[model samples]
Target: MSNRAPLSNKEIKTRFEAALMGNYGLPAVPIASGSGVRVTDADGNVYLDMIGGIAVSTVGHGHPRYVEAIADQAAALAHTSNLYLHRGEVELAEKLLELVEARGKVFLCNSGTEANEAAVKLVLKAGKPYGRTKIVATENSFHGRSLGALAITGKAAIREPFAPFGVEAEFVPYGDARALAAAVDASTAAVFLEPTQGESGVHPATTDYLKAARRITSENGAALVLDEIQSGFGRTGAWFAHHAAAITPDVVTLAKGLAGGVPIGATIGVGKWGDVFGPGDHGSTFGGNPIACAAALAVIGVVEDEGLFENVLALGERLEANLADHPAVTEVRGKALWRGIGLAGADSAAVCDALAARGVLANPVRPDTIRIAPPLTITAEDVDLFCDILKDVLSTAPEGPNHE
Candidate 1:
């Protein structure tokens, strides 16, 4: 390695602001490196990574096994496009099907949005024969930013600006079976749902609600699409959160933690819905690359071998129990490792910034909700540290929203 000095935070910020688009605005912290469940910023300030790259770092940063898989795959073969069949892709697809406990076909993509886009086409084609044109989604739900996926995303703030969304969709209140049943009718092509809504403050749909969706859609001949993009791959103590419902969905979308921080996504079509698309239907250039598939395989293997699911359950219980009756918290939402701590009168954003300053990373998902999804591989000690730091930060949390 060269003996040159590292870029200072100010220098890095200047170049980043000048070069990158303002879509994400300015990054609050400039991360330099990560290991296990912690990350160091540009100024060498270390913080426990509670959010884990927005729930994408499944096996944690720089895991030896995960890194080895990625490196080995890249050295052997990286990109083959979708033209040629690859082993990693096939194996990953088979493994996902086995975990879902259903016979299905998997369509690989590079992100959750692309997977949802493929889902749109699948539902559209599946419904074409029945003259069904409408889709149903839940209010406050976030699917993706792409035009096709945005059509079904019910959050009006991000979705409304790109109006004339092309697809016909109805919004229903999440966890309300009656509204979902009422919305999904003969003309409905599909009912898209998140088993646990992650982006809009980690709210999990009830088991009964999901079962109702399955039954209602089956009766009306509409596809039941579960967007497990944020909840899948053991984030919820299971391969997929919908597994708890014991009802097979027509389609399911996955990404985020699938490849443990590597960019990858998958749209799984179950049963008859699997055969919806044939040649020339849809495709992605970098979808299901060997490196991504290998990484996903490694993650699955590690999670299973190390019993990380059990770890998630144990640590989750401990963490939730500690925060349950805290004075600064109103309520805790979500299941297992995926959680949202609702603040009591305190502003979520301000609390998060305070926590960051004290060496912990979290996300203010909503004005009053602070979301924390730590790596499943975290130990009991790590959980305790998080709880202690969170309590300390809350003691001096800013009174309200930062007006400045």
Candidate 2:
């Protein structure tokens, strides 16, 4: 481990501000230790973690099983590179493919961006010789910040700066089958979409729209790529949100919760598209490291053994029902534990701040939309506590500028 002395929150913040580039805009609270759904700040003030590290800590913080898995893997063998095959990597790949019924194979990486980047390259390579170059993506959809993923991402503000690296892609309104059908043609290489748009305020794609994408992509000989980076691994109560839509994407991008906070990403291709990439086409040095794969296997095991999906379904219903009656809340959208609450006149960021102050951690996707996606392993008491705190915050919050 890297040697460094622990400092107070203020000291840490000061050092971070001085050294790091200003991009994330500085975090308000500096957290120290965390367990389950609770995290303690430098001052020892505990807050219920509703965001789950932006939906990455699927099994909650410091899960014993995950910890043990990592410890065991470290003791046995940490890494052997991609040159020699490792059992943990093969097991993880098999498990993921079995879960999704993906026909081809799995390519592991480090983050959501890398997974999407790999998918983009694979689609481009496969669609070539057929003259399929244009990629169709939905408006408000976020792939990643990398050049390839950013090129296909929908947000014009995020994409405009990197226009030089932009690919031949078209944008269409999300959840609109007609628009997607119109956008995709024979020349389109792939149609990429998030199962549930997490960064764009937890907007879920309609089942009809997903079905339409599959149909259109198939007809046009374009690969259908579903980005489940934020909604996979029981975050949506189902194994994947696309399962609810009753459609199978040609390629699926996964990350965030796959390894229960461990940095890991996977791109699973289905059918003949899996063979698009030859052995020498793509590779990663630390992609399928044993430690990460071990962590993922443990996460998967715990999710299955603990029946966390059922918990997600039950608690999600309660959360949605409790928030729906709030006068300040305009809409609650999403399935299972992944939900977004739209406030009527309150600023979403202000509401999140208030929740944080009241010992509950939540985040705002926009001025009007606040997303609630706690860990799937969160208890009934946790949901009830969050609801109570939210109710109190909503009751006392002052009306702000209604930007939405």
Candidate 3:
């Protein structure tokens, strides 16, 4: 019951350890401030932020435009609840629709989990009188960890704990069009796939696989839902990674970089499915608040106005090209800033730790795979610096047990 404020990193860590749950282990660094693509720890150590808060900060930290927009929105009005219409929400939805360029309507929420949940509800509602309840998702896919999303997520370790939810889902091997086709049936309500599997080591879906899913889902009367929570909003150089496959999904779930760093999620349904939810079907109290919508509008404007997509494309190419020839890097995968570097015989965790110790930050999505999802605005110099640091870290990283 101490009301005392923490004065140092050590004090803050101590307070967190005592008061917070240990689900995320412990934060490696106590960050005090961040700007552009860099963050400084309370201990005065600065590090290049390659993770971008796990691909959430698309426009990068403390962008002046984003700051101004949030400030202006807060000054004018913050929350009016979803019962009332707000101009910022309408503007953001319109901008998102223009970017996707498919016929659709958006349902806003608070996070990736909520977005997927909203999508699941919509699909179930639309397919209802049909008695379709099954969903088809791919193996190694990582949807958010909510009950409904967890059931659809392919990872058994996360789904097994909540068996009583009674949500039936089938998982097929990723990148296998035949397997995906075989899994969907007449009773399937939806087929969920990530354009690029983020938490499962950045595995991009093949064009054939995506097209096959689109075809099979349509044939089976199932909605094709693409979870672009991690790969959307210029993370993959394109507004949506599925654009590369040249197939439009029935539903698209988005979050992550939508509002730069602000927490927001959107479940957009294309064509007829967009109107599945009526006035009382689904809603969130803080979903389309003026502040978050304003933030998203600002983020979208900056991405387009500043041409961050081209930057992502150029930097992503350089990143992959530089690492492609590295002896330690087995394979470099992904398009744009969302990249996965597969290590040959080395442990990715050790390399990530080594990189962190050398004033750089990267993450190991799996034991053998490290994901590098820097901001869309990351510069060529930043990519070069990251490559140099990674090369040095790989050269000196100790051979040890691998833990993801």
C-alpha lDDT of all candidate models, in order:
0.92, 0.89, 0.89
**For candidate 1, lDDT tens digit of each residue in 38-83?**
9999899999999999889999999999999999999999999988
Considering every candidate listed, which one attains the maximal lDDT?
1
Give the per-residue lDDT of model 2 (tens digit) for 121-152: 99999887899889999999999999999999
Give the range of the ten consecutive residues with the poorest summed lDDT in model 2.
395-404
| TM-score per model over all chains | 0.98, 0.97, 0.96
Cα distance off (Å), candidate 3, residue 395: 0.5
Q: Candidate 1: which stretches are off by over 4 Å?
A: 1-5, 401-404
Looking at model 2, the pairs that clash are none
Ranking by TM-score: 1, 2, 3
Count of clashes, each model: 0, 0, 0
What is the per-residue lDDT of model 3 for residues 1-404, given as tens digits with 9 covering 90 to 100?
55765367787788789999998877877888899999988778899999999999899899999999999999999999977888888888887888888978999999999999999899999887898888888888888888989889888888787775668889999889888888888889999999899999898988888888888998989999999999999998889999988998999999999998889999999999899999899999999889999999989999989999898898888888888778878788888899888887678887888888899988988888889888788889989999999988888767645433
Query: Candidate 2, 301: how far from true, in Å?
Result: 0.3
